[model samples]
Target: MQETVRVALDAMGGDNAPGELVKGAVDAVNAKENIQVILVGKEDAIKAELSKHTYPKDRIEIRSASEVITTEEAPVTAIRRKKDSSIVVAQTMVKKGEADAFVSAGSTGAILVGGQLVVGRIRGVERPPLATLIPTTKGVSLLVDSGANVDARASHMVQFAKMGSIYMEHVIGIKKPRVAIVNVGVEEEKGSALVKETFPLLKECSDIHFTGSIEAREIPHGGADVIVAEGFSGNVILKLYEGLGSALIGEIKKGMMSTFRSKMGALLVKPALKETLKTFDATEYGGAPMLGLNGLVVKTHGNASAKEVKNTIFQCVTFKEQKINEKIKACFIKKEENE
Candidate 1:
């Protein structure tokens, strides 16, 4: 028998739980040739969802869990208490090497805490940042520490740059990614005390294509290939980017239907407009991966559809095949020695 990519999914974790989650697992299995899904949730709930469509029994299986982890629960306490919760169960599979990866749309806090506590980090990985790929005017830029690593040290930001560059190059297929530290000014002297200290470090490093600082205003113009920041700023940037893109698309849509002349113009430009705006839609890039962990872990939106979930699964295949974590450590350690 050939080795297969087995993913343990937390079926009860997402906003659309068991329904979209289970549906997504089935979709991933259907789309990928050698992938098996072990859905962790109430067996009956999974069965009910599966009954809605015909699926290959061997490809999709459900593991029963009695309790669900709500967002309200304290993450550490919840992971400790809800031993049978879908999130914990899914993480455990990765720890045991039974599954190749784990995907969750559950509590972001719980998932971040669980990934480190359960899956553990790679050797010498101090802070594993949540890295997401963002499309820029030039192309896609990998934004590191997009959710985790708040109140970061200068060292963490440095690591984020190195890891982000490795991910963009190996997994996302960007070569010589221009790594930039997000700042209020493009100059090294500008930014918070943290950014100012880290600016010089990134610039002095040879492993990454460390460009100067990138202000938020310049992100849309394809200013940088990888934007490195602490989680606080990166999260704000990520949310704003998503919001701005959605708002722009919404205005375009409403405008298209406003008048007969506008309607005809919309019809003429529909295909090109869609192709252009598709670049801005975050879902097209798949979920953000919690990089530097011992095993592959991706955090999708709580309301992710089957398409997003499916793309994330395929991303795992490439992340693993590319040996992204190993490459990151090598790049970082080499940079460290050079420093």
Candidate 2:
């Protein structure tokens, strides 16, 4: 029998909080028998949203949290003071083993700070990086330190490569995944100080299939399976990727509706176009997981809707079943043993 993956979900964390979050929890429990969701937020609001949908009563529970963290609040101060906030309560559940994972679409800073402070890091794990799956021509690639550790060192990036490889192989089922450091040019010599320093170390890693440096242009072409970078550059790439994708999609839609002839063509091509476009949809891939944490902590977009919420909850199930944390721990343990 499959063990149930218990998820602590922050019901009041996103723009569509309580309603979309509650609906997502209901959808997940209804769809998967081996999943349980503990909704954490204001009791009245959560209950009101719950009334709008029907789900397995035993599979869904509520843990009342009176406070909510906003984006403007200082992450550290908010986490320290708002002990009863939804993000805090949910992450605490993970820390205590009350839940297998914590999922939130709240303040990104709070999630990062809380994951490190409340949930804590795995043994031997330095700074845990946020690993997000970005769509590529072939399928998807894992971008490590996408929004975490801006001041990451070469050693930290090496660990990111290892962890990213583990996740892609075990959870995403990519065997012997290719690893590459992000650089301005394909040459190992071209990049910022961080990249130049990290390149040689990654190439020498025996555990991972280290490919040479990858240019940003090659990212969409699936040049590498695992792209490693410090948070500053990785975040820039992610934002640009998202912005460009949206702009192109908008232009495509506008062109398709420009004239009567285009409208006729659009009707015939809409199905195929949608199927192609779905591959690039960021929400379809779920939220970014903060790898190397003692327990799983996922941070979705602040505007995440019910679909993204549901997908993220399911992503947690895969992470649990694949024993991702255990594998990551083993990798670090082996490294420690070697050193």
Candidate 3:
């Protein structure tokens, strides 16, 4: 029998709240037979949106939440004060074992804070990291500590490398994923104090395949399957990568439309180019997951559209099926035993 994965979705969160969020929930249920979505928000608003869609009645549910958490509010304070907020309620469901996962396109701080406080962490996890998959020429690479743990220690980076390798190998279906630390230069002697300290520890890890340093320029060429860094550096690399991809795509379009002769060439390449670009659309893989949590917590873009929301919801199903949390717990426990 297939295990049903129940996801508690924050219906009142995100820039396109209630509308796109509701549509995404409906779309998710329609797309997957073993998935169920519990929409948490104002009952009237949720029902009003649901009235417009045609979906399986048994697969979608509604839970009333009175308040909504905003991005500007401090994370800890907002979570403490807004007990009835959609984000908190959804996270609570995961903590209580009522749901297998929590998904939100809400405040990043709130999600991270709530995930650690509400959903809790796996037993041996010192610090949970936000990991996202970035598109690469070979395929996708897992970026650990993407926007979490800004002031991480060498021990944290070492943990990040191990967890990232596990994620890529299990969830992403890669055999012996290559792990690399983000560095300015390839030399063993280069990098900051933290990277320098962390490098040797990662090298000593026998479970993961440490492939030395990976410069930012080589990331696009698929130099490694897992990229490790502290939150500050990882976040910067992520933003730069996103901005560059957008700019390059825009320039390609502009160049293709500049002259009549180019227009004919553009028509010839349009189909192939469109197909090629689809592989790079990060939304296809869903949101960034906060790893090491007791239950899964995924944070999507604040302005995510229905497609992104839907994809994230489906991603939850795969996570549950793979028993990722159990694997993470065992990995950390075994490491502690060895130490």
> Which runs in model 3 stand beyond 4 Å of their true positions?
none
Q: Which tens-of-lDDT digit does each residue in 53-159 have in candidate 2?
A: 98889999999999999999999999999999999999999999999999999999999999999999999899899999999989999999897998889899999
- Which tens-of-lDDT digit does each residue in 86-163 have in candidate 1? 888889889998888899888988899999999998776788999988888777888899979899898888888888
Question: Per-residue lDDT tens digits of candidate 3, residues 127-200?
Answer: 89999999988889999989888999998898888888888888889999999999999999999999899999
What's model 3's lDDT at 255? 100
RMSD values for the candidates in order, in angstroms, are 2.2, 1.1, 1.3
Clashing pairs for model 1 are none
* Reference-based lDDT, residue 91, model 2: 96
TM-score of each: 0.92, 0.98, 0.97
TM-score of 1: 0.92
Top candidate (lDDT): 2
Question: What global local distance difference test value does model 2 have?
Answer: 0.93
Candidate number of the best TM-score: 2
